[model samples]
Target: MSLVVRPSPAIWVDGEPATALPIPDRGLDFGDGLFETLLVRQGQPVLLDYHLQRLQHGIEALAFPDCLPRARDHLASACKQLIGTPWAALRLTVTRGAGPRGYAPPERVVPRTIITSAPLQQDRDELSAPITLGWAEVAWSIQPRLAGIKHLNRLEQVLAANEARALGVDEVVMLDARGLVCSVSAANLFLVEDGRLLTPSLEYVGIAGTRRRLVIEQLAPALNIEVVQRDVHAAQLEQAAELFCCNAIRGLQPVSRLGEQHWQDHPVCSALHAGYREAVAC
Candidate 1:
């Protein structure tokens, strides 16, 4: 499929007016930036705090100047631009403005922040249905420091997504070097085994999902569900009765097929989806 190219919106670079970013921006050159894709519903940005907190955390990790206020201002402006628009997806990006031709970062960095909005997605509800999942041949490298953080460096996820598209699957479930389940190319994974909910720990792999946290916090207690974090291999997934993938944007998606492994209708995933919906509504 062709890459989706949405029109770029007005942006702010170091508290100034800009649209096209500079060529020497460290974000484009070295992927030294952080971004958050927020769900805008009813003209409100869903989980705004979570997205900003993550962005701030990522900026600190990269030792970039604090660009939260500027980013927030730009985001607010973009949301105002979409006043009559019912729904949309907003992308907020903060990059280390520009640097020399070297690995070392500049001393006084002026971060560039961009906020853009597009037509809202209709695929959010599709997660309630079953989805096809495939395994990526590209094993995810274990990076504890980078784990749980969303950064601009996502070549691994991009490649895995391509592999999934080639395999005709909705998503690709990636494994680490130790042959343990990590996550899908873009979302987190969960399996229902022996009446308990289990997911791979992000301590050594995968991104810490905002939706995942909500599921763990709200649904785990109300449903009396056990949420386990540990190593799970391909074999375990094959033997599992039900599976699902989730992200704040996508919500919860049931898994119907994983390569040749076919899963029958399972109530656990459906129940989880119902519970998650209630939580999000609340």
Candidate 2:
């Protein structure tokens, strides 16, 4: 697929076009919110159900009001505006509305939804291209309370991405404070060893990505690959036969280099890449 030039994103707040959010919005004040970045194809969100399911989990975990109906309505309206666009990136944000001057949330809560859409500047070939990774010096804090939800506080990722840019690598592998492999700066990490797929458990850190779930629950089973979720050590990557990172936006990206270790295009990675494309097409 060819990409379009970047354009100013269309913005909507609570189902209506808007320019700015209300002051004291908790999303901006305290990073108190959840957001989903999705791919839009021909005016419809790809893997919308998966995105909504994750969002629902976040809503429940955060104890926010029921926002799925409103979120769906807003998303439908936003998709209508992109009816002819071949590809676009959509971001849906849900916040606990504006709150008083402290961390303590009000007893009666109201949620706010913000949606934005912009032309997606992506080349199809780039998605499968192998890339290099560097180990980040910063480590993830183990916070089970915020482990798998895609909340708004992303300072850790920001710092790690900066480290990657300084190292001149595509991405950086992040480990938890306990010195166990977790994930990359912006995606989920996976390894292929002994003809089986291995991914780290997210009980203490890392976000459980929608694409990761798809791979474990559907794609890997279709290929008869045994999926294993357990604590992975940084040393394991050196012994793995293959390495790849995945997320909703980019799908699957194979890692070619990490320090002295390097990898070529492995068959397992290739099959999964092809399967991801087919899955998205449907």
Candidate 3:
């Protein structure tokens, strides 16, 4: 799909056009930045406040220049401009600004934050039917320093995607350095076994997705299931009754097949999807 970029609410440095991001941005140079992808439904951006809060937390954690309010205002205004679109994806990016060649951050840093809106894209088959997943031989490194944060250094995900493509599957299930299943290449994974829900612990790797958090927090109570975080292995899938992956952009998705294993219609997955649809409607 062709993307259309719009002017953001505020531009701190010289106030030109927010659409024109510089080439030498630290985010591009060394992946010294963070980003959040949010779904914009109708005119209102879904879970916008949460995305902003996470962006602020990441800025503080990474010691990026302070400009959260400006970024927030710009994003709010940009969302206002995208009203009446069928569906949209708002990608908000924050960089540590242009810096020297060395690793040391610029002493006086002016953070560059950009908010762009584009039409949301979805795979018809995956959304309608269960998706097929595969095991990724590429192992995720255990790095607590960057764990749970949506940092720009995404080589692991890229490699995992390549492996999944080679395996001829829709998504890839990744294992951490310790040989425990962490998550899918792009989304958080969940398993259903004996009416209980489980997901991988993000203490070491994987991004804690906003939609995944919402599901575990708001939907688990209704299902009367304890959403426990633990390590999973490829062998453990044999015991799981249902498997799925989730993200803010695509909502909850069911994994009908993973490698040689195949799953039929699962009640838990249906209920989860129903609950998510209700949540989105509300």
Q: Against the true structure, what is each candidate's TM-score?
A: 0.89, 0.96, 0.89
Candidate 2 residue pairs that clash: none
lDDT, candidate 2, 157-197, per-residue tens: 99999999999999999999999999999999999999999
Better of 1 and 2 by lDDT: 2
Off by over 4 Å in 1: 1-19, 121-127, 279-282
Top-scoring candidate (lDDT)? 2
TM-score of 1: 0.89
lDDT tens digits, residue span 6-111, model 3: 4333332223345477777898889898889887776577767667777777788798767888777767777776687656777778888889888889899877
Q: In the order shown, what is each candidate's alpha-carbon RMSD? A: 3.2, 2.1, 3.8
Error of 1 at 131 (Å): 0.8
Clashes of each: 0, 0, 0
Error of 3 at 183 (Å): 0.6
lDDT of every model, 2 decimals: 0.79, 0.89, 0.79
Error (Å) of candidate 3 at residue 110 is 1.3
